[model samples]
Target chain A: MSKAAIIPTQLSIRVPVLNWAVWPHDASVPEGPAHGFELQYIDAMTRRRLSNLTRMALHVAGVCVGKTPRVRTVFASRHGELHRTVDMLTSLAHAEPLSPTAFGLSVHNASAGIFSIARRDRSSATALAAGEDTFGYALLEAHVQLRSDPAAPVLVVYADEPLPQVYAARSCAGDRPHALAVLLSHEAVRDLTLTANRSTEAPSGGMQSLAFLPWLAQGESGSWTGHRHTWRWH
Target chain B: MSELKLQIKQLIVDALNLEDLRPEDIGDDQALFDDGLGLDSIDALELGVALRKKYLLKLDAGDASVRAAFRCVNTLAELVHARRTDSERTANE
Candidate 1:
């Protein structure tokens, strides 16, 4: 008898909450001379270490207290640590030598490191830096990892900082760096179904490309284009 | 020195993005690491970077003296003053 290929089923998410920190209609970078998102607005958002998105994680983590502390965490950022990287490079150019602090924080995964340390979570944490398609890619990773162990929940966090002047010149799409994180787990009530299909190009308009909160807030669903990737939610 | 100390305190607040802190809140000699400001290793690193950028001073890994300089904002300003004079001496020589 021929062996049949196993097609994994996606686990359902219960009590899913999406949080965002968006800076719209305000200039995050004023004469910053770079394309990357500036850290100027970080303080504007909140004064806490976790920021807005991580605060959401804290709540989501609470919902799954005992179930958490072991679930894998996936973080996606399109332009991770751009400001710190810019500062480090400029210091190096002058032979000033990068500060150990700046260099450490400049890593793409630094936020995840902070999140892990704060939570005292020793679970697996994955940091991804895929420009444009970061959101869709993160969701896909979460779905795949969720299928690996149906019993465990997966926390997926997506964050972006605004472009600094140098990076802005090259890849400034909009005026905000928004973040959203979802805790995916198996629940009896299935809230949503996600399927993937082939697409030749990204859609240019719609709410799908925006953060999940806005989509939920506006009561809109469907395909949307963000950066270089297309996302569809029905 | 006191004036310089005040400036350094403000710098610390700004660099760390300490929203609720005020210049009067931080005592000059209190430990900036754990008890006082609740700063961690990352804060120390960021402070070092900010200090170097503002004062144009390079930290030497071999020297225990560097720790004394980073002990507090006052100490940092004193170190900057001394370095400035030392550089002047070298140029004159």
Candidate 2:
């Protein structure tokens, strides 16, 4: 990897984490169509239209949210529903009309929007993507939202599947579908610290978001190296 | 239910990804949009695609009769029955 552009890496941020959740925690099963995911949390009507990535993303988001009401959300993904996009592109190539549902939910934040609709939550939510560093940036976003409003909690969700075989070379998913979620607040049960330093190492496998789950849920601290810097969480 | 209605019901269920709903669960006259049946505008467009692909249907979204036919499975069945090829009409019965 070429030298990454210089970025501010000295400002240490401490974000209070209230709760966290992750899907397929075992890591044995790879990211694909088949999983043990259930649909009870999502209603029959809405769940019908969800793709595997969205379903996994929503599952962890729901688990983290639990009965917690009105939490702002930041859903980040490296590739948002790329499978659906591929299918649509294929249809268009043959001069075919695209599926309406596929077109409607192709945006990166579709899962976030669906979560809001399912929760009947009108709170502010953001859907974002930042290449392989999506998880780190989403945490930063949640940290900002929590600092801005001390009263409410912010939900940080990162879900990504291995790029479909066509886009596999650029994938950081390591060929496994994973979603990691953390509920952040100004003051919470655990004190979580985030710091970054410049790095020139080539990006590696494993979802950084899932790697950080251990730090939030149990371990003392962990470091994830990606995109031009190494992010340390404690 | 007539043979055509049953086929349309199956198409509706499959095309909309209505996993929980069976073909029989939908009444012949059940409202299809924003009512008891709980379909939205997107569902309408999806059903339109299903119709076009399966029946080679030519749909006119702006037409008043098209809107009416989309109101219920019974109306949709009728539209399909009227629009299908002669061989399909005879084969279906």
Candidate 3:
């Protein structure tokens, strides 16, 4: 639980060189092929192994890192294949043998592992889950990695699907599957600053990543206030 | 192709999530791994489970013949047909 009390004046990060989002069933989202993840970058066999969450994450990550052989990656998700986990639990309760493939792909970092395997990427990767602050924390992790190595860009991906119907009563986030990916480098073309502070505000209703979409899509430099912190783009 | 072969082909396609592929598209004799359908070890494990669940067939993971039985659509169909016949014969006896 690292906390940042002061906003550093010299802290800055670049705008995304490539950005992609997928939200197929969201009515507010445009009905088009772009939102439909074809996952053409992954072959049919490998694509079959992915759950919806992994597929979405891999799709956006693939689009962001097109042609690049190797790059650091940060994957963040709130629920992360919760449906698959539920399936595993149901199988256990029934005394049925678990599907080996399903068990292998049920981890929190499964999307990142699949992306690395599909791309044959051997670079460092990180997976984070920080409740309401997952997207922001993932971005900060990517920025830290970029600071360590200024040459290679970092691919940050945030993806999550709606919680299973069994947990619908407890779900706090939106009921749609969504994923967002961005390629971040050290070069400050379009600067963004993240500030952390204590606040008593209630957490937002939807995915934290969605808050940045308006700014990212419109290229508007503005500030977005979150549950515990705020982000500003200039 | 035989109806059993077609059913097995459909099973493979459905069980393995072979997107954009149909039963007729997969040749009866085409290899199921690496070159033809390009399935891998994980897919093989998944398809094996699907076949067992659908057909109630007994499969031994350590059996040497399992690899040969899973080479292609024709081989897999033959294996299923033979196993089903054996099970029926044993019941009749």
Candidate No. with top DockQ: 2
Q: For model 2, state the Cα shift of residue B39 in Å.
A: 2.3
**Per-candidate fnat, comma-separated:** 0.41, 0.76, 0.59
TM-score of model 3 (CA atoms)? 0.80
lDDT of 1 by residue, A1-234 (tens): 332223222223223323222322133444333222323323331324433333333333343333345667787777676777787788788977566655655676766676566556787888886666666677778777877777777777766655778765665445354545566767522344444334447555323325455443443555645544445664
Chain B structural similarity as TM-score, candidate 2:
0.89
Q: Show pairs that collide, candidate 2.
A: A31-A177
The candidate, 2 or 3, that scores higher on DockQ is 2
Q: Is the docking of candidate 2 incorrect, acceptable, medium or high quality?
A: medium
Model 2 lDDT tens row, A66-157: 88989999999978899999989988897777899999888888999999998899999999998767888898898898889989999988
Which residue ranges in model 3 land beyond 4 Å of their true spot? A1-27, A30-35, A67-69, A220-234, B34-36, B82-93
How does each model score on TM-score?
0.69, 0.86, 0.80
lDDT leader: 2
Could you give me the TM-score of model 1 versus the true structure? 0.69
Chain B alone vs. reference chain B, TM-score for every model: 0.79, 0.89, 0.87
In candidate 3, what are the lDDT values of residues A35-60, reduced to their tens digit? Answer: 46758767666677688788788877
TM-score of chain A of each: 0.67, 0.90, 0.83
